[model samples]
Target: MSTPHPHHFRPATTHADWTKTDQYHNKYLLSQDEALEFALKNTDANGIPLISVSAAQGKYLYLLAKTLGAKQILEVGTLGAYSTIWMAKALPEGGEIISLEVNPKHAKISTENIAHAGLSSKARVILGPALDSFPTLSPSPPFDLVFIDADKDNNGPYFAAARKLVRTGGVIVVDNVVRNGRVADDSLQTTDVVGVRKLLQMVKDDKGVEATTMSTVGDKGYDGFMYILVNEGI
Candidate 1:
């Protein structure tokens, strides 16, 4: 083992600190939104899991889609449509996003939330497994951005499908890849961690894409996203 750099070594930040920082950033950078608040409240009322992206992360997704001028987007999961609404709000007229949800309850609630956000014209939630929906998406317009946040155990398959669905120069984002840092520990072989590892290995062997992992610490604890840009020439 190599010696660690003394100046770089430091105690890990606590979850409380991480949450405080997220709150601070959200208060200053993310303005209050009635639609989003309502969606969250409705989700809670319906007993849906509150695993949607944080405000800061949602804004990041929004900005990413806006920056790309994405006309078509695909989301592998639609939990209450919180993130869907965020990204949908960034779309221009005629732009559309299709979100897939395996759970009927989640899909129904997501549809309602999208309508509540006044984004019904731009965002649609499909009730079905993402793998099944992927096949039906063919022959349609290629997606400019694909966000995969569904069951982690199927991440490798999701990435493979996303590669075929997304257009050249498009981006694919896989969330919760770090799984509280368990992904890197050999002893931690949870299904989620193994799925992420498999996706990483596939990305490593794929020469047609450029990809990187970004580790994040926030209210959601330690996790990360794997971002891949499809470029056949690369």
Candidate 2:
């Protein structure tokens, strides 16, 4: 008998499987918290796109910030402040997070959500294009962590701007980079894909930062994040 393709021996997993796994992990790994649930519910009630990170992903961001002892955070997107709330909660007593949102509606809703989470003291939502807001932050302390999750077309610009504001040894994370693995295919010239490709090339060419990408699958489906660490020499 001829040998079968290796695929024949492996079990196939579907979106349902990924979702179930995410739920399973959330059940055991996350604790009940009213503020976080309210953030999700309020965002949906306000008709904001439910594109914020999943519960597991939010917790992951929280843990990352907590582990880094991040005192200052700069967030490029503040959709409903879901992820913002998570990261803000990880800050120290005097730590602060400045989140930027281009949509006035989103900025308003996120501001409300942050206040509801009792994190208004730790987080602030700035309404405007991130590029416009970046200049205003020049006088502030360098951010220890930066999260970029806004328009894909501006990914390159956002990364470049963030690199300048982040402290040496700081971390910068870009979300939704893989786009279901389309990033590797040059034939796909979608703006989002093209943006990610360009950002990847920029990172590869930059000697001041060390970076890596991680593929993820959950209730939100397949996507990935890019993590870049600024070198001390820079």
Candidate 3:
């Protein structure tokens, strides 16, 4: 075996530092409360994949929901409900949030965490493939915001459904689209990256939505989210 590169030793540490500083800045300037802290602990205790959005990202979601005055929100992934709790806190009185999760264990823990946050009345965790659950979700009032954070391999389908479920003026946010910058390379055809590219193409082809993608570097390493705004008139 060849000798490992010296740069490999510092990357993880450097990434951790990046996340720490990002979190500190967000927390010092903004604030994340204890409920989010307990939800993170719940995720760890349940052995769920610690893949929930970072605190800063969670706060961003919360603020976005509040800014939108989102009455009905949909989350495509409910991993331990850390982000779920954050977004749910933005709901107005009588507002509701529906979170979809494929893993029953994850749904169970998400339900527990949401309840622990005193949001059970406003939030519900559905156990099923998001594709399957989407059909049953109502589009009556339509979702003011839809957050897609599930399996990246199905992002195209999720966005397609989100378009149908969101109001004309609503917003859709798909996370982890950048995947450490792999998304910029056309030769790499990983399913996750391919799905994101397909979704980008769909957005480009559809004139009803205005969309943009942004890259982020933090504790989650390098990744990004796509923000799509649905405009009136298809």
Candidate 4:
């Protein structure tokens, strides 16, 4: 008999179950509050896609930034400014975050939301295609951390750009890298999958980055993220 493929195995928990359990635990551990709900409502009222990171995930980003003591952060997507508000709250005085958004409408709405969150001074939404806007960005002190949660089809290029923008010892996080575990299938070569694979290969080829991917199942489904730590002298 032939050996079974790893993908054939059943998961111990369903995505819905995991999301519910985790979110519940997160509320207890991380102190769930209303500010995030307010942001969601702001985006909803604006007719923006209800696709901002989940409450638990937003908290995770906030904690990560806080742990890094990040002074300059770069975020590639500012959907509802939900995540922006989370990270901005973690910033110390004089710390700032630049978030890139493609849609002018989205940028405007995000700016309003950021201001509503009382983070207008620390978070700024740059309006334009992230790929085009990246070149114009000249962080005075270089980004201490970078978060890419934009178009998955261009993850490879985004990763390249983020690598250049971030300083040594900085962190780079790429969201939705797993794409419901489609990344493991060689037969499936969708544009987003191809882009993710290309980025994985680039990380493998580049010695300067110490990277790893973690698979996650949440309310958004079976997507995951890539975490990278930039080594010195790159």
Alpha carbon lDDT of each predicted model: 0.91, 0.93, 0.89, 0.88
Q: For residues 4-114, write the lDDT of model 4, one tens digit per residue.
A: 999999778887797898777876877755666788898999899998777778889999999999999999999999999899999999999999999999999999888
Worst 10 residues of 4 by lDDT: 27-36
Model 3 agreement with the true structure over 57-174: per-residue lDDT tens digits: 9889999999999999999999999889989999999999999999999999889888889999999998989999888987569999999999888999999888888888889999
After superposing candidate 3 on the true structure, give the runs of residues whose Cα lies further than 4 Å from its correct spot: 1-13
Candidate 2 ranges beyond 4 A from true positions: 1-9
The candidate with the higher TM-score, 1 or 4, is 1
* Alpha-carbon deviation at 39 in model 2, angstroms: 0.7
Whichever of 3 and 4 has more TM-score, that candidate is 4
Instruction: Kindly indicate the candidate among 2 and 4 with the higher lDDT.
Output: 2
Arrange candidates by TM-score, highest first: which order? 2, 1, 4, 3
Q: What would the per-residue lDDT of candidate 1 be over residues 21-42, giving only the tens digit for each residue?
A: 9998888899999999999999
lDDT of 1: 0.91
Best by TM-score: 2
Candidate 4 off by > 4 Å: 1-11
Candidate 1, backbone clash total: 0
Q: Give the TM-score of candidate 1.
A: 0.93
TM-score for candidate 2, please give it: 0.94
* Count: clashes, candidate 3: 1
The candidate, 1 or 4, that scores higher on lDDT is 1
